[model samples]
Target: MTDIVMEAKNVYKTYGGSSKKADLKLVEAVKDVSLQIRKGDIKLIFGPSGSGKSTFLRCLAMLDIPDKGEIYLGDECLTKPGVDLNKARARIGFVFQNIYLFRHLTALGNVELALRRVLKLPKEEARERALAALTEVRVTDCANKYPAQMSGGQAQRVGIARAIVRNPDIILLDEPTSALDPELTGEVIDTLRDLAKEGTTMLIVSHEMPFARDVAEEMIFYDEGKIVETGPPSVFFNAPSTDRAKKFMDRIIKRTTRE
Candidate 1:
């Protein structure tokens, strides 16, 4: 059997609840969601804006705690409130849409800092791992450059290198290419494809349809905080089981052809 790296069971998460009548209403971001990510699986999630895909990814990464249900990393419980999470969290990596590199730090320094501080690797070892990671993303040439000095793509590559320096069991990305121009976006997509080929398990929430269809082992269509359909790209892209999925594909195709 393929090993599962992360699993969610009936997970639920909400935001912005208040007793006051004038206050914003509660938003159910994830509702009764359950899924498993197998080792080395490139799982792609697609949905419209505010469809809860990003929220679910954050819950998996534990950046946003779920209001109900359970999450597991391997055999250990990961979502129990107040549980010791350092070890569980250490095994996961996350890259966000907004590349959050410290402007003062060089690309190499940014990656090395995560290795030394979070993983507590020795200085020399961290340097070696950081450089390897930079090379993996083809950002080695930008290692000594600061974030302000690099293009959007280069900065994001550094962000990815920092995320993978420790070799986490699974990497989570939220709209990694949504902000880049076509040329830069292609580079990021190429880097991600290389990682997938190298057996890095990933859960990606993206609108890059072509890349998702090509790289994903499984694709999920989420709507209103629920997974409407899940299948391989061959089925999801060509023959979606749900009307919502079909409509989504139609809209996307129309938009692409128009552009």
Candidate 2:
């Protein structure tokens, strides 16, 4: 009924508080964020550390529960203050900053396990799907190779393949290229672009402004657990429309100039 592939409304999260210290206030990670991503969007969540950008992305992906808010994937309510957690989670695929493949399992095995175990897919079907996903990521040659034998970029691509194998409605990437060299980063970025073009909605948390500029259809800047600005990359980068976003972009500019 809607074009939105994902939605997060009035979401909130916090940390660093214990029952022993009721007076110890929670460090808010996300504050009443309400955002939407249309189907097939490649959206960027970019901001300085502790700005709550990462937390928002995680909550959108269903990896982290929102303390208060509602999330919807398509017509389905995944989270509504409290709701069907399993169904909503099933529609999301999460990728982390570090690739955490099972060392004992070969690349193929790692991808296959998820499909077989979680999805309850038959062996043959799981193998076919896993191989195709790996090929899409251009890591088919390394399918039989163990994670230890692969480079960081290769491992990350495999991580992506694992994510796509589930064929989830949304892919959540947490700094996918933060560890790779420039050349390797290019490979992964290209793979990501292909997925975006294919209409797999994705929300990425990244500090790579150049890549974000190239890949994102929309950009959101967060500050102090709040979304400061959301707009197309052209506008967000060129004209931030807010003091906080302007200051954030200034820092990005400085970082780029120094590097």
Candidate 3:
């Protein structure tokens, strides 16, 4: 039995070398990035835009294949060949920045689809679980509403419900609130806070400093395709060990304060 829910070892990813342009350089979006998340851990990754945080997250979820290194969900190596990736992915929930709800389906339908299709739950069971998940995210009122009918916050909450309905071992959230309007951000944050209180194991790529400071057990500072610094939230809020992290924190804090 292992306490580690997920682990990444020397994970590497690149892009753009396949372009026809001769001068197009290979961009290393994730360079030898390694991370470990234990049960009930809430770790936050924050850095400059286009720094490959999202790429690393996608690799962890096995949504994007890594060029080098290994990803482990518990003891199972996801990057290995012949693995049932679809089965593995079903155990790992992923919430994207853009709320990718199915426009044709209502909120409940979006959540129930995975249960019925992937998990193969009975129709009545799927509906019950979907409604429960929506209630957990405080979006039960949006159950019958289509994506186009809900507010941004409600839609994102539905996306979260879709992610969590399967009761995956861990949830990987990429900039969960970044796409929402500033005022709407709080509702999503509140849902996340409730999830945190429930001890959900989460690895989130977010810049929501206030929420991070309040809920994250560890904060990782990533930049230039590598993890530059990592520590408890106090280390980043007070004084980061690395100059790069310090400068980044200063810029982010200043911007947050201004907003």
Maximum-TM-score candidate: 3
| TM-score of candidate 3 on Cα atoms, chains taken together | 0.98
Cα lDDT tens digits, model 2, 106-195, are 999999998888789999999999999999999999999999999988999999999899889888998899889888998889999899
How many backbone clashes are present in model 2? 0
lDDT of model 2 at residue 132? 97
Error of model 1, residue 15, in angstroms: 1.1
C-alpha lDDT of residue 94 in model 2: 87
| Global lDDT scores for all candidate models | 0.90, 0.86, 0.96
Off by over 4 Å in 1: none
Mark the regions of model 3 whose C-alpha exceeds 4 Å error after superposition.
18-21
lDDT of 1 by residue, 55-91 (tens): 9999998888899988988887788767778777778
Instruction: Compute the lDDT of residue 127 as modeled in candidate 2.
Output: 98
Model 3 alpha-carbon miss at residue 109, Å:
0.4
**Which of 1 and 2 is the better model by TM-score?**
1
- Predicted structure 2: lDDT: 0.86
User: TM-scores across all candidates?
Assistant: 0.96, 0.92, 0.98
Q: List ranges where model 2 is wrong by over 4 Å.
A: 21-25, 80-84
